[model samples]
Target: MLVFQLLGGDLRGALGPGWEARIADPLLREDIALAAAIDPQQRSLDARSLAARLRGLEPRRAARRQAREQALQARLQAWRRRRELRRRRLGAGLTAVLGVALLATGAMYLKTEQRRQQAETATAQREAMLAFVTGDILGQADPYDSRSSGAAGGGIRAAVDRAAARVDARLHGDPLAAAAVHGMLGNIYFAQDAHDRAITHLEKARTYALASGAGDPAGLVQVETTLCDVHRIGGHLAQAEEACASALEHARRAGPGARHLATLKLGQLRSEQGRHQESRQLLQPLLEQDTLGTDPRLRGELHWALGLSARALGDYVAAREHFGQLLQVAKAMGEDSSWLGWAYNSLGSVLVETGEYERADALLQRAHEVFARTQGEEQIETQMPDAWRAEIRLLRGQWDEASAILQRIRQAWQDRLPPEHAQQQRIAASLAWADAMAGRTEQARAALAAVPRRNDPAQARARSSAWRTLRWSRVALALDELERAGELLDLFEEELAQELPDPHPLRGETRCLRSEWARRRGDAALAVEGAAACRDSLARYYAPGDPRLQHLEATRAAFAAAP
Candidate 1:
């Protein structure tokens, strides 16, 4: 306000002092102002005339500029309204997106937490199971305890039973743990050859492992593998086969190790079922690929199973190689004499089949000595050597010696074997052959009938089955039942045709029997042909100095010279 006052407020034409010179004619003054406001057109014109004309042009120009400004203002308001609406829509979309993101994040967090809690609970349950087994079961093995002292077999079984009794209460709601515990117990009983108890516990274990809501693939595979082994040993072959196949199916999902283990066990079962070629199909790959891996025990078991298949297929060289590998593995592992005894016994059986009698007898004697020392004289293993010794006697044509040995072991076999077993059938067949040789015609017939005939060609072509049929045919020939002998030979030939190679020792044995049948039928030419075939087949397997070779030569000469 002071500055405004000091500047002579509103002083542009104030007329303060000497106002007379600044004053002009009223009309002239108006004309001069109009001259300044308007562009200086017609400067010489009178100021009154210019003012009158300028006033007339100003209204029209102002009206036109006003109309243009109003139109531009209306366009700006329309654009502003559209921008506002777009901003609101973008804001709403962003809000919805943020809401969805928040919901997804919350759901993810809940899922992660739930899985973490479940894993922790499973871990705790497993730890609890380990503690229970270690503390509750194994800790009960105290000799000083009254219960341990009184219970059978130092209370190992009693302790297992006690632990099993508490499993429902202690490990409730944890079916996986229960399955593991029962599977372990069943394996324990299986190791001890307690088939009935093993079956009960294993079935229970499988039930828990295959439970609908709590199925455990690893547990299922392991339980089935063990059940296959136990069932096969207990002579329940069909059940064994079913269990083995199921184990393999589950093991495929489990892993390669599980698959290989299951396969090896199944191969052993197939061998027992007398499906020798099928057994080889499953087992030979394990040998060729070396898939049993670095576990000596598993490899050794595979070798033994392969040997069985090879021998049954009449591949003596392959059988020897497999058994030889088994013995080397067993010896390298520093296995007990019992395991060595089994290996030696396996190789010995092959030696017998190939007509290496001296080597076979030596190996069998070593096997017998080992069995006597490690297993004692009364054990089933002790009887294995005795059975093979009878085979040796029969091979040497000492029927009386073979008969005496078989008779001595009959009670032992009766004690150990089930009502129907391959080993039992083998024994019965051997006894029948020996009895037939001794001229006990009626006794041989009854003994031969007592041994069940294998119907499947896969079963009939096996080593034991072939030998049984050979015995049967020989008995028929001795009784002058040429027709029956011919039929038996035909069956044998059909079985061998399906599986055995041309140069197999089984082929040699087949030829020998055919020659005998042809000689009896007075078909001299066929007898000569069969004798020559026997010589060709047997030469590969039998030692040059073997009595069987010399016998084969004599037989060939006799057939060729027949009238």
Candidate 2:
């Protein structure tokens, strides 16, 4: 019981209470005896002794609890260390991932910005180039219109020069734009009859246009065609032909309208070369198109070309009709006096050929007035009409008046034209004719010798040669050099046959010369027959009161009355 009480708590307190009652249970007594046998000290312990013993054991239990607490604290510290290590590793990996993401994003942004900057730069450059190219076109009046005169501050030539200078300064990198500017300059110079300057710029334009891959093919073709025209006017036929052929090929690629322009240019070139049949064939179909009538510029050009070709072919009716149409177009378009003057001159020249002298004279006078007003009286345009009028005077046997007009034209042309220029040659030829007609044989021969021979066998050259030969034949006959006269007449006839077919008006003049030669040779019957044929031919071609026909009629009468 005492042991049981000590095991429960302090033995003295337990014994005071239900110690005896607890010990009275047989199982309890047996447990207490077993405990006593194992632990005698515990069995012998009283309340005071047990209390002292329990107090002694309290320190060891406290020591063990402290040890367990220390172990638990150490384990918790280890777990915290492991958790902190894992957190640091995770943070470092996240930081690396974030840094890479930021870098990639920054690189992407920079590339995008760089591309945008480049795009903006390209757009700016293109805009600048476009502005440079279109400035002249937008800022000025029409450069090609003769009636506009010019702007308030400057004329077309000055404006074009300023624009071209700007282009050269600002548009060096843009080949296509530069090409367009050069072409514009070329047209301006060509209009002013500065052929050398025109050719220089046009050739440059063509070169740049060909080099620019993205250039407008139609525009390139137009530049080439303009180059062809400048070269043609400058009398570089081979270069003009080459340029025209190239333009034609490019025009075919451009479209039908461009091709049509190229075709017209080629036809004009052919006409200039005196291949009148080919020119007529090439241009006739285009003229017949109903659509072509609506475009006055095109119609006028076609009619002008047709008129020139027809006149060369001795188709006077067709020539007159074409010239009439051209004049109508000029009037309809409200063309300036310069254009009207040229149209009137062309029509009047054809009228002269067709023996409508009165109408021809009226038209020629009107043309002269227009030219005098528009292109100064001393200008080539005015001189041309004056020269034609002088030819009319020559045909009427007003030799002094004809000589006076020829002298004026020759002096003016010599002052203004190059020594070897075609116009100068024409003036020289005309002066020679006048001198021969006035019976100044030596002066006539000297003037003829001064006219240079062109190496080309072109129709213009052939015509000039024929006229020159006829004048030489007349001069030889006046000098009584019969053999030389016969030789010159033969040469004149050959050139006429080459340049004109039978029944041509020019052939009547040749036949008259032949009759005069036969009369000088004392072949009365031959002279009579030749004179009769010459008179009939002249009547068919010349005006009713033409002096050449009157002279032939008198010659026939003198032959018939001869003893």
Candidate 3:
């Protein structure tokens, strides 16, 4: 009955009130007789006694039922507490998982957006750089178009200045575009012969190009090669050689065309440095290449360099051939009048050196006319031919005529060039020579003094010193200062030996002077031997029956007939 109550049993409710009367009728008669015999109190039982007993049992059952109800309520409370705790744990875990997922998604979205923005920014920068460079290129004058007028009536220089500023402002953030702009500006400056400015910008261009990954190797090579040219023109030979070597290294990796350009520049550099044999060796291979002949400008430059090297080496025949080729190329191009004039002047100079005075005079005159018409009279090109004409006059013993021509050239060069410029110094040396030839000893000394001394280590300075010493010796000889003349001659010979090869024309000229000095000293045997050697050298180098050869022959004859 207790287990049934605990399980919320209905066993007591299923027993009806008649269930006790039926159980008493079957076996109660025998059990009651036995209980009455054992205890006489069972016979005296009444309805009041049974009522009291039932009432007492009812209280106990009520108390038991109350305790069971309390236990069930306690179990129900415990089950509800466990269910709530499980629900709270599940909710907390779900919230944590959701928060982490949201954070990861937000971070990924932010990163993607940042990348997209950066890409867009890069695209904008590239487009802006392209527009800037294109605008600059279009605004500038055509480099090859000689007839094209200056920009906005301010001249090409003004236009370049404006374009340069714009490039700096618009392309500052884009290194590659900035390099290209700088290279273009450098080229313009180079064409104008503003060597310092050209070098500055070209170096900047090269620096930026390297920093920008050197995407265009050919462009870098061009920049370096132009730097080499600027340094060479400015007489900074060591810097020029460094630039040329760098350009050659880049050109070799770039392609054949770039390599060819670098090779030609190196040959020109070697020639300027007085390494004629090396220059010829470097340029000889280019002449045989079909690619070299295809580009007229390159072909002309190669021929010009070869001609100079050959002339320096005293190979007059080879020099003349190369100059002729250059002239032909210049004519075939017919683009720049300056090129044609330069070709004529170079060929004429070679002819003058070989003692073909008549032909040289004709060629030089033609060059003078061409330059005067093309580059104007005040230009350096126009003035150089006059110097060559003065040389011819001096060679013919027209000392006054040569001196007058040199005076005009000197004045013109002074007005246009720097005081210590190489061309000006050379003109000064020529003036001194002409004055000495005309027997103006004091004036020759004064003119030589006016020629500035070059402390710079350059081939030009060496040549200047040699020429100055030669002129000083001539003046000393005219004054009959034999000891001073001998000293000057010795210095001249030393400089010549250092600066020029044994077969150089200037060496032969030095021998002729030594012969004259020997004759004046009354050493007849020494004078005859010197004169004979000088004549042989002149005959071997100069054209047959040339005026210089005849002069040497006359000197030899005079020495033989003297006592």
lDDT of each: 0.71, 0.68, 0.68
Where is model 2 poorest over a 10-residue stretch in terms of lDDT?
9-18
Candidate 3: stretches off by over 4 Å:
1-153, 415-421, 449-476, 479-481, 491-495, 498-504, 543-545, 557-563
Q: Per-prediction count of colliding residue pairs?
A: 0, 0, 0
TM-score list, all predictions: 0.69, 0.67, 0.68
Error of 2 at 551 (Å): 2.2
Q: What residue runs in model 1 are displaced by over 4 Å at the alpha carbon?
A: 1-173, 212-216, 335-337, 369-379, 451-464, 554-563
Can you tell me which runs of candidate 2 are displaced by over 4 Å?
1-159, 162-166, 335-337, 375-379, 451-468, 475-484, 523-526, 558-563
Question: Once model 1 is optimally superposed onto the true structure by TM-score, how far is the C-alpha of residue 332 displaced, in angstroms?
Answer: 3.5
Which digits, one per residue and each the tens of the lDDT, describe model 2 over residues 1-563?
43353222121222222233433333334444544444566565554654454344435445756897799799979977985786687886577675776699789879978666644443443344334433553356353554423344454445555565566666678776677667766776665556777788888888877887634677688888898988876667788999999999999777787888899999999987767789988999897774355456667888999999998778888988998888887675443436678788888888766656678878888888887876556566677777677767766767788889878887776655565555555556666666777887798777644433334355344335455566666666666767767776776676545766677766777787788888889977777777767777777666657666677777777767876
Instruction: List the lowest-lDDT window of 10 residues for candidate 1.
Output: 2-11
Q: Is candidate 1 or candidate 3 better by lDDT?
A: 1
State the lDDT at 9 in candidate 2.
19
Better of 1 and 2 by lDDT: 1
